[model samples]
Target: MNVRSQIKDYIAAQPEPKQKDLQELHGLILGIMPDCKLWFLDGKDESGRVVSNPNIGYGVQVIKYADGKNKDFYQIGMSANTTGISIYIMGIKDKKYLAEKFGKKIGQASVTGYCIKFRTLKNIDVGVLEDAMRYGIEQTRV
Candidate 1:
């Protein structure tokens, strides 16, 4: 019904270890951004097709496009995927910064342009993840 409820439902729907990981991540994100605006995306497009996994979002960032368009989106987002979980740090201008800075330090996670993906929380360094998330939030600040 609401963003918080949708996020809880999404986490609860996960299976086993994933569920636990999602719960932990949810708590961790909130601890990092205590007063952030929460968001929930059902992974559906305008037509309601399941285009992606459900995402739990934190904070707010305004994205300005090259075509003079802009929209508000989450600064950080987490989603459960088939193989693992994805933590997205949106609004980073430099696409290669994430991989170059935290790719090796983040343990077994894959650090892409704006996403850190790993099979489980246990497989990655939580501290490094936190640092990356903090950097992302700072970079996207309005």
Candidate 2:
């Protein structure tokens, strides 16, 4: 199916409050980047074993590997995990920036190099999250 359809199916398959949160986040991200490209990754390998949670991605960023190959990828990604949800802001250079800048301000979320993880949306400050995402988008823009 198409990326939007896949994203809908993935979000619909999530359990309980997480489903609601995912929907809200989907809309929120869209509001942030209204014309961004959508992406969905089933998180599987060639063997089809479940490797990671399915991802709903937004925007585009080109990744350059050490082997000199380049690939297009999402600038921001979201997924439901066992304990919570993970929001990945993929193009930041400083590993400590998120944690140092938004960690304390983002409520209960864990701010890592390029990810903001939290148990639920209500437990975190959504505005700071938005700021981080905006920063990521700006940083990734070519």
Candidate 3:
């Protein structure tokens, strides 16, 4: 199945995920972007090891950053755990931009020189996030 389908299936499989939370997040993405394609990364890095401590299924990917030939411009990933939901801005090269924009909440973001990690989706401004995502579609050139 495709990433978005996989995500839908995964979330549906969860017995007790707060329905409103799931719907709200899903709605946020759909509302902010109607055309993003999704992908699944299976929680393993290129080396084949789980990236999170407790293994949160897989990373949710959004392909809004794809190039003209349909190559991925960038991948945005997300996962939820006991702590909270994380918004992973996968593969960002511009730290200055992110830091300036998100520093107010994400604090000092740990950079992969690629991924920008947020502990909680609620911490940052949704509009700023949307703006960044839009920038990904426009200037990022991934």
In terms of TM-score, the best-performing candidate is: 1
Cα RMSD (Å) per model? 0.8, 0.9, 6.1
lDDT of 1: 0.94
For model 1, residues 1-142, the per-residue Cα lDDT tens digits are 9888888888999998999999999999999999999999999999999998889899999988899999999999999999999999998899999999999999998888999999999999999999999999999888
Which has the greatest lDDT? 1
State each model's CA lDDT, in order.
Answer: 0.94, 0.93, 0.51
Q: List candidate 1 stretches off by more than 4 Å.
A: none
**Segments in model 3 whose C-alpha atoms lie over 4 Å from true places:** 13-19, 45-74, 105-123
lDDT, ranked from best to worst:
1, 2, 3
- CA displacement after TM-score superposition, residue 109 of candidate 3 (Å): 8.8
For candidate 3, the 10 contiguous residues with the lowest summed lDDT are 53-62
Better of 2 and 3 by TM-score: 2
Query: What are the models' TM-scores?
Result: 0.97, 0.96, 0.57
Model 3 C-alpha lDDT per residue in residues 89-133, reported as the tens digit of each score: 554567576556655654433433334455444554656665655
Error of 2 at 77 (Å): 0.2
